[model samples]
Target chain A: MVTIKDVAKAANVSVTVVSKTLNGYSDVNEDTRRKVLKVAEELKYTPNMLAKNLKQKVTKSIALIFSNFERANGKDGVLFQIMSGIYAAAVDFKYEVVIYTRSLSEQQNISYWKFCKDHKIAGAVVTGLKTTDPYFQEIVNSDFPCVVLDTDLASEHTGSVSTDNVGAAKVAVEFLISKNHRKIGMINGHEFAVVSRQRLEGYKAALSEQDIDFDPTIVVNSDYSEESAYELADSYLQEHRDVTAIFFASDLMAIGFMNRCREIGVRIPEDISILGFDDIVLSSYTTPKLSTVRQNFHKLAYQACEQVIHILEKEEKGRHIMMPFKIVDRETIKEL
Target chain B: MVTIKDVAKAANVSVTVVSKTLNGYSDVNEDTRRKVLKVAEELKYTPNMLAKNLKQKVTKSIALIFSNFERANGKDGVLFQIMSGIYAAAVDFKYEVVIYTRSLSEQQNISYWKFCKDHKIAGAVVTGLKTTDPYFQEIVNSDFPCVVLDTDLASEHTGSVSTDNVGAAKVAVEFLISKNHRKIGMINGHEFAVVSRQRLEGYKAALSEQDIDFDPTIVVNSDYSEESAYELADSYLQEHRDVTAIFFASDLMAIGFMNRCREIGVRIPEDISILGFDDIVLSSYTTPKLSTVRQNFHKLAYQACEQVIHILEKEEKGRHIMMPFKIVDRETIKEL
Candidate 1:
């Protein structure tokens, strides 16, 4: 129960001086160090012993580094929920989490490596994987253990964690087919992410299974924003007059598609059925709601944290793990 | 440079055994502990000093506890951004963050508090204050060092951080007045928060400054969300047909105000100019954009961290610090 303050008061020095002496910050005098240590030893200061042993090795802290977390599109969605789940598990384990916002590019410029080095971060959780991010190589090559979400980061030094993207996407498109829609259009996300590519592949597979020829003219890529997707959905409604249903890569895009359809006198389901991926919180609240692929982000991040800890603690299970996804039926899709 | 894996390997024991032995988990065998310690000493294994100190004292973490982070209205705004600032500061300070979300009423279910205690949290950032919260009294009176964001937190705590709500709101309303608009309306956040009340005062202050009669009928109070604010804004617009411009408390509500105006066939600026507070990122992207008050949240959180750390470490200085806000002119406001 001996505190740094007690040591500071006893040694007649600032807490900063006491902290520097203990942490080997190399800024304090030798006499002060010995006096503090003598008092600390008498108090049975187990700060770096039983409670925090020189023999102790696990700090049980990890960093979840993402970009612009709160400003993520659509006001709410899968990303936040997944983050919540990670938080829940961490609290369960009594582990502390450090949230970092530096992207690979930002990391390169910000001198945050010095910060990371000083903090002794043992591992990290990475999200928002743009394909050509310069930080990926550093992460792959770093000494710390890591759990990557959404990114297809395969390396021996790191543990991969994500939802089954291809399967989720296929189920989304196939559900529209089950609803009896043949001519379908898609509002896709930016091509920089592996999930986007996987979802696109699933889109192709679903159409090929139903003998529906995939048409490039009806597909559009957006910046995963509601307004941009709304504009794209409006353009598609004009350009692809024959398309009966639409599949969006994200729930925000589906909302946009629906909003635009409403603006243009096209009724949801009755005029053009829409389906989306990442069945986030807003999916259930949107008027008429949205039928979409359900990626259990909570389970994904929770399992990712557990897996990364397992790997960091040398459980020696595997290098990669994937969480499951499902289809959530809502009102956005209709029987053609 | 030595890790738990190295110690475990050296002692020919599981890493969990090494962890439990050092953590004093009471489950590790005495013989196993002795062997782990011996090997760890030989390997010179050292756990992170900060993490160890956190374990010995508090959890080296703080929970920024919010009552229903997913507020029922689904309007994301300045609140979440403030949460981000808190998180960023926690990261910089090497403090672990845990977010506890439940309804304000359910907070005293006592489980969240027990979780914090179990995690050994040093303190918490209390947000989303409500009269019905049972846990509020317990936390306010506790020995823990808390930094509160809610303006209505019993006014007993010394380490409180907030924005200059009255000043921010006054600037926004005065801006509308300067533009030659006389008949202006107002939207206020939930009546529960003291911060909202200050803003309401600022609105009336602006009216009083211009010697205009204070019209309580033109003011509407709703939860800080788009959907809920939509109904209230709709009702206000329905009753007050002559109001030329309106000032909303938050940007999300501003978007809702515009959406309701759009529904009623009233155009922004041309029909009824609108001004929103808390110029969030979407304010720039919202259709016609949003003109409102802006709070630099990054700086706000940074200062809050500096304040809290100062209070805890520097023996309680600068008990109350208020950051400034500014008006952001956008497309929604009409020129005289």
Candidate 2:
């Protein structure tokens, strides 16, 4: 319960002097600052950040607004990895992180801008936001400082960070083609997701370049869920028996497809080769392992934090930042 | 920016009336309160929570202090599920949740009490703390409202929530015993963790109940890491050739043991049965799946938040809460 007044009295200084010294103002004498800090430590006086933020009209805090964060459970560890990266960067920058989970439907009643204002958030890093969401439009049109993940939205104060989905997908498909598999199919994620569309485009580009006609009938879409992919796998396999290989938009979907293939006695790589994207941890543990494009979610989240902080500090303009991706060869793919 | 003064002026009311109305003070007349709210909405005014907290001397905010949260990456989604539960309860209770990641070493420089004070945190729910940690002692001795996860420390102001590890472990081991396995070994997690100790006790209790002598030499310890378990598995298997079954303290360790078993040409269930604790998402996807005990991390975290909030609101005395656990049967175990 020790206050600034107590620290001032103990240090034989005025409250203003104590405040300036504690707030790290250069106007305070070095000796006086040292004495004030010593007294404050002895008194165990902790400054109230709420009052300080109110008085200074600034807060050294950011909100990590995650849409559909509940999906993190029973799924891959992508969101958790992103959270770790965000926290690491927040620690380095000495900023506090507040987490807010919002479903897509919640935007009708809540505004992200007002949430930031009420919480005194200096900036925000949002993920899992679709372009069609009401909050996405609000963020795109507003001047509030924000960094989005895996989205193409950018504005005067809104930036984005994501892996080069198109290029990575193309490289993966090309690798499959190099293995003498010309009849390649695709299992894409939700059509609403930007990365899904980008990956699909890459699939087509790789097919056209290799003189393999792009077959729309062989392409399937899942809701980025393992169960959905599992359900789609049986029918997709039955209809496309000539497809020599298949590219999956995510590791989770690939895992689901593999599970179904196992049940139906379809041997991986022997019957059909499989390639996956977003090399989640499970990719390494699957029965035949998995060949995947590894996107560093940690780096993506770290850069998103840095981008928002940079925008808030006026050190950089908001813009899209594409992180690097790597294609990892494992047991799932086979040469003809 | 819209202010209280603007709302008051537009509503033809005084600033004090506007403030009182917005703050939900019952002293304001109903019609006046409605008028103030309507004007505030029209003006697009969002109340500054920082300033309101400073004036009210109470904050509707809680901190989720996670020790070694970085371990969440590339691992199971236990932490993420806990986070989801905490957020869900926070929303229901109308409280804001702020995340704080602290390593054991960080306590020397930062005190939890000071952190809660500075951030105006009404209470806190901390997870992944060891009994030997400096912060554990602080929580035990301090009067600050807190809820610790998976620890026995509880005080007049500090509560705790965890699964009934001893009972759950005993049940799992007893099931293995029922399968006619006499020579059973165990791979426990870090010795510093309370759950590890509790589960070890449970393992011993099950042995005693079944009239089987406990063998300390066969019980090895890992750091609850897959790599550590994988390394330990080779030596343990080589030395304890007579062991018919093994119980693991965590699913991650179990998976590691399974991986090592696969590499060393040791067939699971046929050669030796395996049981694990903490049925994480990976348990369902492993080669033979994993028969394990399931602790509801989501429920534990939700109850921890509720406990802390209850203590803060003077609705309940801080005490330890033991949640139920389940035994999940998969493909990892078999009759000897």
Candidate 3:
């Protein structure tokens, strides 16, 4: 078996320096740490503390912990894009990522440390978790290295990554306004989600900027699901037929509304313009292709992984990262 | 700190039976095995032989090893569906799954056993691997418990799971033939994939059954990519306009062809009928929706995990399982 001595010799470093570097000590110089770690990895020198204790002290691995687990499985949405970024970054950083989920029931039953210890995970990136989830609190308190997506815990140990939701929402609504759409309605996600609140603020900000009074009656809070958005749009359209355009918080909801519109004989762009957020995979493939605010989930995931790994390596403090977003102009939006 | 005695006592089983059950001895009855394992899990009685030796005797975990590493990150495809199934099944079976990939360079640099031992994965499910891969042969010869997808190794320690690609192909082609289309063109994925060959056989079988002459000029081999398929369709349409319908071995290719057709002024169903395989999530949402063959990738993944676990438990010899497939009809096809 390759030993620390071999790696230290190859890197021309003392065993003490090698040990400190492997254990994530901050005193090691960046150049020396890089040389030592690179040599150790090339030699495949895994610290087999498993022989002394069943739990490993360190491993070149990360975990992607997901809440609302179904999103982890859906490929047509932001989750897949985020995973793509994480996977690419993991390959580049020479780390393996294990995908897992801890349900509400499991959260109450096990400590986050035990979960990570059992899996021998070095660090983690968490996504889709709501603030109310007990696991969220556990993550906030645990000293374990982690980064949460689309939520801000403001912890020293835990980082956060997300799109500039408020800015992206404002851009989407402003695009509609630029197209002379004044009677614009909005469909937002659940109130408890940080993204929903941020997006709502953006919507209101855009309306206020245009001197258009925010119509509370025209805004509907949905559960970020297509079925709920579809039903909401169906009823909202029947009562508020004068609304020229609608802005949805997610592409799934936009797609659902489009499906419902087709059933009700409402033509897209011609009868009513639509705007969506996230620009999920389905958004581009759908007929008349949805025009929406494109949040780069891949960049968000990449930043989260990079931040968590940097924290693990003791190279940087945790950061609150907001990835870039832009508007994708397609067939869904029309000039009145 | 829980021991075999506690688990045995809680489950009303002998310590010997509990040991045998945990160690994967088939002599233990099914009910007794379930009871003992459940009790052991509840008591958190993980065998800590890692202290004595780095190799663990038993672990409640499986490895999902993917080939073609790109597919692992793609959400708009069958890979995601398979992963979803595996994740769900693993949660039910009390097994933690680790997802990993061994690149061709990595495979050549390390022994398969060493790779598994380093990761401490008890068993693995390998998907998207070509038969020519060195790791595939190593897996086939090794005693490690495994289940492979879309390929048959016929190894006693390994099982295979896939839709009846040949049969599904025949059904799809026959559906096109039934609509009075005689000059049918087939676009196939790379020939190295077992699924590609099987689907080819199916296409030929359908033609043979209908007593229609198969023309070599009308067939195109693509690399299972939309870009390749789009280019092939573009060129094929320019040269062979007489071909009334085309059967693409994958939905991605069909979608690519559709996009190309639109660019070149060809109409679907009106100018030519179209058929696709693998009815991905986007298939249902596309314009005129896709008329294609649907393979239940979720069930395919579920069975792969179940088979791998069954092999790990020493319950039965690994079996080659063929999942069912069906033709999904929508607006993409029309009777000639």
Worst 10 residues of 1 chain B by lDDT: B69-78
Ranking by TM-score: 2, 3, 1
| Model 2: per-residue Cα lDDT over B1-336, one tens digit each | 677888989999999999888777899999999888888988988777777788888899889987776665547888888887788888889998888877767887888777778778899999888777778888987788999999866788999999999999899899999989999999999987899999999999999999999999999888888889999988899999999999999999999999999998999878888998888888988889999999898889999999899998974678999999999889988886
TM-score of each: 0.64, 0.97, 0.86
DockQ of each: 0.09, 0.75, 0.37
- In Å, residue B176's CA in model 2 sits off its true spot by 0.7
Tens-digit per-residue lDDT, B93-150, candidate 1:
7666656665645565454445455445656676665645676666666555666664
Q: Mind giving the per-residue lDDT tens digits that candidate 3 earns over A36-144?
A: 9899888878655454245544777789988644655484556766766787778789887878888888888877777776666789999888889888888887888
What's the CA RMSD of model 2 in angstroms? 1.7
lDDT (CA) per prediction: 0.72, 0.88, 0.84
Q: What local lDDT does model 2 show for residue A321?
A: 95
Q: Which candidate is the best by lDDT?
A: 2
TM-score of chain B of each: 0.79, 0.95, 0.84
Find the candidate with the highest TM-score and give its number.
Answer: 2
Model 2 chain A worst lDDT window (10 residues): A66-75
RMSD values for the candidates in order, in angstroms, are: 12.4, 1.7, 6.0
Question: Which model scores highest in DockQ?
Answer: 2
lDDT of 2 by residue, A198-257 (tens): 999888989899888988998888877888889998889999999989999999989999
